[model samples]
Target: MVAFLDEGGMVDFTIEYELTPDEVGRALHRGLKLQLRAVRLAVPTILAVSGITCLLVDAIGLGVGMLAGAVLFPFVLAWSARRLAKRQLTYLCVPTTLRFTDDGYEYRTDQSATTMRWPLFGRVVSTPEFWLLFVGKQCSAFLPRRAFTSEQQAELDGFFAARQKAGAL
Candidate 1:
């Protein structure tokens, strides 16, 4: 197990996790959703329908514009997502050693290591399968639920809750 010193200079706990591609995909998808929360995702659907209506009415210019908007941007996002994932795949598709303390957390992979205090994460979100840590809209950490025992998850929940209650998270 990995170990990191807490504020009290005590080694706290560790969780070893190996990330899978499907989990990475879910993480990326959730990260994208967080980033795009303010964006009008419905634009594509609306534009597609509008484009069809415009074509039906013989408004070629508007139809093409709407269709183009509906078609191109999502493809761009998809392409970018694919490209980004490919670039980061090597780093992600490895074993990870997560060391943590009451003060912060240390994320370690063979490619890189990062340490961040709890306050650095502006948001913490939980899905059925993951714990997502965010700094602004960017996803900073992906903690798979499968990695933790139920007791560990509960401990983390309490830890997070305490931080949140203290307005430190």
Candidate 2:
């Protein structure tokens, strides 16, 4: 299944929805809240890890070890935080049109569309950025607000609610 969100018939602050069979790949997208949390966690984790490493190295009389850890810790932490944030955006924040079918849902973004089957759906979680349909431990497809208009969002939300009730999700 496939879905398309066109811009031609767009209304002010309105979103459009359509379904198609072709699959497009997903993109990098992350929620502001999740990104912030990840960043917040990174600082403490980095400091702790670096502090421990520095102390251990100092006790061992390895002066370079402390210097290395101090220098590398912040860089590694920043990189990790950035990477995780990017992953969240790619797997959970990017905009896409989702089409539901017997197999799974087809998520279409500007770059590509990808199929996310039911078995891959560990759970469905929602955030302001998107409705995350988790496929694996950390894999997900992001359905952004841009995918639907305010009215359409309500309709789609109702549709998913019904599906959940019927155990069709």
**TM-scores, one per candidate:** 0.77, 0.46
Model 2 C-alpha lDDT per residue in residues 1-169, reported as the tens digit of each score: 2243446542122233432211112222333233345555665566556667766766544445554655675567556646655544444444545665445666666867776666566555565545766544353455655465566666556655665667666
Candidate 1, residues 9-79: lDDT per residue as tens digits?
54377978888887887777777777676554777888999999999999999999999998887777766
Provide the lDDT at 127 for model 1: 80
Candidate 1: clashing residue pairs, number: 0
What is the alpha-carbon lDDT for the whole of candidate 1?
A: 0.79
What range of 10 consecutive residues in model 2 has the weakest lDDT sum? 19-28
Residue pairs in clash, model 1: none
Evaluate model 1: give its TM-score. Answer: 0.77
Top-lDDT candidate index? 1
- Where does model 1 exceed 4 Å of error? 1-11, 40-59, 71-79
Give each model's whole-structure lDDT.
0.79, 0.51
